[model samples]
Target: MNPLALSIAVGDYDRTRPLASGAVRIDGVDPLMIFLTPEEIFFRAFRSQDFDVCELSLSSYCVKMANGDSPYVGMPAFLSRAFRHNGLYVRTDRIKTPQDLKGKKVGVPEYQITANVWARAMLEEDYGVKPSDIRWVRGGVSQPGRPERVAVSLPADIHIEDAPEGTTISSLLAAGEIDGFMAQKVPALGPGGHPHVGRLFADPAETAKDYFSRTGLFPIMHLLGVRRTLVDKHPWLPTALLKAFTAAKELAVGALTETGTNKATLPFIEQSLEQARALMGNDFWPYGVDANRKTLDAFLHHHHAQGLSKRRLSVDELFHPSTYETFKS
Candidate 1:
């Protein structure tokens, strides 16, 4: 038998580095990894429909994919610590409270992804600000001249573009290039909070809980999705992939805990724990079928409200229930 191949997509972040590492550890082969901006991932996926399986931010991707009229199936849940999408930060000096963001510029790489959308929703829902109230700027892959990339039905003003990742956004924030930005929570804080920067929203664990409570949505930080036809052809592929990833999550968690206080990887481990608490609450389970379904339903409803999709995506259309059942049973 040939070694099974799976293609995975994810943000270029250090925390997610374990996914690649775990792939090698388990399969003895490196999964096909595509590193790109969130926007590029969506465009590439929609245009070419390439790759047997791909990972993506769950909420935003669901909106875009469903809007494009593609019938792609997403994993029932995020891969453990991989689902923490509630990290949004801003310069503490500029935007002290969420309400202070009025007329200010907030940067995000892509709006179609959950980070931006959920952040916006939180500001509006929690803080009581209209999405159009802020000055949306698009920061491209580079720091200098990226403008906002607008979504189909989103308010025209609710978009901005900036440097590709949080590192650049962090730099821009430190230098006063941009007011605020959203990124992974653990990485948002460094030794002394970036000198010139202050955090506006640093409670990813809290945000995750609040999101689940308010919207019944578990913001998917990363997802493993297969093309519909490939799923139909290879029924076992999804199960095998999920099993490998779930095992990877466990190993990653164990490795982090065992290496506690090592100084080198302690921060990463701590951050992972924060994310785990957020996603799974006190008792964390990497694979929780009930929670996963609830999240899916929330995501579908959000997309529908935004007018991104005309119809609600059924659980069957979005995930392989059998995969979860097989794993649990």
Candidate 2:
């Protein structure tokens, strides 16, 4: 029989596509139900109610609320890795340092529940500049004649209207249309292509190390969560899925390495590996039991201190009960 239907909300399905098309026939898994983005999974979880299990980031307050003794519960995974929120890219001719960002307009997609918050935190903690220090702008995937809109919350800031995917943002930076923007390095077009624009942050590796040293909290970029009802009804679901995904991630790592380096995709793959190592160590186990608890506890304590949450939610309550027991042994 085919494996049960499961869904994950993340980037393109390149890694899993091959498995889905193969004859391996994932036991109790359904390849057709996978989702590519968190937004799609969120809407479907609430609307269609079709999915038996879903993946959500641990940092997301929405997932926390949804699992608050409700119908859904979170199954935290230590093996899962966090990706860096690629830093602000700017025109090399304009801004030289984070200090120069004062009064300049910066663009971000989601202000609140995004890697932007962590990126901003790093800037403030390291550079002593608060959010009020810069002109902020909000952009999205929808805009007239453009794939996204440029919406400014601050006054007198130049509007960096939506540009097409590859050339637009780079061109804007090159032409001085917008001061800077944040994006993943995967699709990064180096200064070679856009002459004037270059990365502002010097070394992401050192920055991440410093952030962890100071805060002892690693920001979670993605989380694999299992639904509560499913866990309660079928105790084996969480472990089974965890094992499957862990295996899949290993396969992905191998596939990535075998593909070698292409100018276009090398940066993304390298950065992803870096992130994976930071979050899960070199072993790349996507479902580590002990690591998840440590990371989750640290995150909850930090948020609680910031007055983000009232009290600490127990890991047992958040994750599958079986997971807790499995970790204890």
Candidate 3:
């Protein structure tokens, strides 16, 4: 039997680098790993079904799954995770707190992006701000006239308007046309920066730490998606890919723990890691369904509530059956 050929596209992160460099090989597979920006990868994957396996926006995946048009069955390989507290930016002069955002004009690159979904969920759950309370402006972060990558039918009460032609969200934000903006890749603005824009949270790292302590969720942003056709054709592919990703993650973590020379450039790598462990536990960046049920369920509820996913999806419905288990020794 010949090894299956698969094209896997993901970000060039520490966890996935091993797979691209051939240090970790997928069992019974010839993997063609392409490391690319999430924007490029996602545009191609959802728009055209470009790769055999690719990193996908969890929110978009949920929407597709709910619509019953999903081309891929998910694997539990969460390649991207972040705390979205830092992604919320507001006009410092106009919006002093979360409460100030009520009945305000807020801009978003795309309402369906995972960061915005998580940020909105956080605001509603923790600060008593609801999505329908504000009028949303939608546009590109940097470019003009960008369209939503996928179509979504939102509830009637949620108000969203497109940006004026030839303008971008950054410009609207800078001009104070929108009172605030929530996006994953918000442009830089601060004291010695664009005078009008500042983070909603002054010290985002500290705020994120506090949020984690309260909620116990380090939000997941992206997951590995295998083309459904491929999965149906190759029943063994899910387990094979999952095994390779698991090994690659272990290798990356091991490399980080080698204290003699830091794998990453930032100072206090060791201390930073210890702090994360203290907050999140030993397997801080865990993969798979059992360890991540709470986080996944929370996201599903938020997704359904926000009108992004038409129906609530359980964690068990999100991934291939093979991804939930491994062979017993």
Candidate 4:
């Protein structure tokens, strides 16, 4: 019989492209890949369980898992990772330093989003700023009144307010209504053409590199997940999918290492590759529990501390047991 066909939705990341392009194949499954924006994937995946397999926001995933209502089980194939310092934007005249954010108004697309969680973690852990220090305003980055996908009851000390009915964080920043914004994508109008909007870190790339040099955390943002019912019905599917994703990542790394010409559109692909290698060694982006335990643990700690996760989850609980071991080649 032909393998089961599963619909998988995720970003069109280079590391995941091999699977999408059919260069890598699951052992007992036929994946129908749909490339969508993270927002679309996360909302549909979490709110409606729209796909059989999808990339899930690590923070939101934990929330559902902690609530004992998780519809999906994790596969250790992290599809997205990055240091979030670059995602922190602020009004140039109002918020100059991380310390300056104290007692200021900070905007987020969603308070429970993984990127915001990590960015807040960096602020409190590195600087003296606590999550409660700033009054958090939750809203759409470009639109208004975006609701948190998962239900979360925050700690008593943290203060989060909803944005006004018809205004966005970009508009708030442009008008100086909010002091800063932390999001995976900076608000559209708050940068580029706007003089008042700028990143909190002057040279965000350099700052991210410096932070990584000290912490050794690439900051995973998303992981692949399979609907729990599907996993229950097809017990072998998780392991098979994990194997395919690992192979796809290997292919992506090989593509990055080619120096004949630029593999990506960026002008500094070669230089960036060299820098990454120097800092993180050859296999910078890794899969599996052992390779990402530190980062995972840190994120879990923050997720619980920020009240996104009802319970602190161990790294072992985050992934399916089937993905723990791979067969010998």
* Number of the top-ranking candidate, with lDDT as the measure: 3
Stretches of candidate 3 off by over 4 Å are 188-192
Order of the predicted models by lDDT, top scorer first: 3, 4, 1, 2
**Model 4 deviation from native, Cα RMSD in Å:** 1.2
Give stretches of model 1 more than 4 Å off.
1-47, 80-94, 141-151, 155-178, 183-197, 202-218, 256-264, 267-285, 306-316, 327-329
lDDT of 3 by residue, 119-224 (tens): 9999999899999999999999888787778899989999999999999888889988999989998663434658768999999999999999998999999999
> Over the stretch 221-267, how does candidate 2's per-residue lDDT look in tens digits?
55556667667666777766655555565566566655365423555
The parts of candidate 4 lying over 4 Å away from their true place are: 190-192
Q: Write the per-residue lDDT of candidate 1 for residues 1-329, one digit (tens) a residue.
A: 66656676655544346666544242433477666665566556655766656665566456655565554566653642323333555667677777888887766555455555556656776788656777654443233443333245564444444454444554566677777766443323346768546557577556557666676554555576767786787777676666666665555455555654542433566766677676557446445456566655655665555444556666556667656664355
Compared to the true structure, candidate 1 yields what TM-score?
Answer: 0.68
Error of 3 at 150 (Å): 1.5
Look at candidate 3 and give me any clashing residue pairs.
none
Worst 10 residues of 2 by lDDT: 143-152
- Model-by-model lDDT, in order? 0.58, 0.53, 0.91, 0.90
lDDT tens per residue, model 4, 14-100: 888888878898887888999999999999998899999999999999999889899999999999988899999899988778999
lDDT of candidate model 2 versus the reference: 0.53
Worst 10 residues of 4 by lDDT: 186-195
